[model samples]
Target: MRRIIYDVAVSRDGFIAGSNGDVSIFPHTGDHVDAYNERLATYDTVIMGRHTYEFAYQYGLPAGAKAYPHMRHLIFSEGVQLPADAEVEAVRADFTTHISALKKEQGGDIYLCGGGMFAGLLATSKLIDVLRLKVAPVLCGVGTPLFANVSERIDLKCISSTLHESGVEYCEFNLQ
Candidate 1:
């Protein structure tokens, strides 16, 4: 079975975005961008929530370029529409079934590019196999957290970790 991995960046205080949904505080300096691009290359599919999609569409990736041409892009949203030129598709509401079928066809691990809500759903469903976080140095004292309502304790074993000169730390963990 293909693993579902949440690849997200959060503030030191564990917020994914600040109040008012601002993630502009995230640093784009040093080797972090290059390292992220490299990590993204390993996955054949990038799964995201509507908000995350909008954020990427606005900030991280350029439109119409098919940035990860070799990979399939899947968005989980009830109302969001995919761009005509995008190599992207919206996953059906029957998330579990659709995700399962996607895994069968893709034959590689799935990268969950998240917004907290989406990550929480996957976490609650016990569908995520890995959680990879890029911790930024700054802290948003009050903001959207990385995970919410994840009452069950899910143990994770650290696979690797790297601290960058730009004060961003990357950590990979496998759900155990």
Candidate 2:
């Protein structure tokens, strides 16, 4: 089965973004970023919530456009409307059913792009297979959490960890 990998950057306090969806505290350029961009190349599919997809608008990503051009995009949002000819797919299907079917499909891996609520849903459903987190040095104190609305704990086994010179620590984990 293809794995759904939740790859994201988190603050020391465990926030994916600051209040108002600020991400300026995270590193924008460095060896760690280079590694992340390289890893992005390996994924053939991506899935994310509407908020995460729309967040790219500030960075000039056109609405309905694929955030990662080379990968197939699936945005999970019930009321989200996209252009008729949009390259990405807006999925209003049942989350568990859709994700389960996607996992059975042939693919390298599905990149769960960034969304605390979405990640939490997948984690609680035991659907997420892997987690790759880049822990930043700063703390947001209060912001969007790493996993929001999780109803139960999901145990994980550390697969690998790397400390970059930029003080960013990359950690990989698998559901246990």
Top candidate on TM-score is 2
Lowest lDDT 10-residue stretch of candidate 1: 59-68
> Per-residue lDDT for 46-85 in model 2, tens only?
9999999999989999998998989999999997789999
For model 1, residues 47-153, the per-residue Cα lDDT tens digits are 87777777766656754334467778887889776557766787759876777677677467888888788888888877889998999999899888898667788
**TM-score per candidate, in order?**
0.86, 0.98
Model 1 residue pairs with clashes: none
| Cα displacement (Å) at residue 158, model 1 | 1.1
The CA lDDT at 58 in model 2 is 91
lDDT of each: 0.81, 0.93
Cα-based lDDT at residue 31, candidate 2: 83
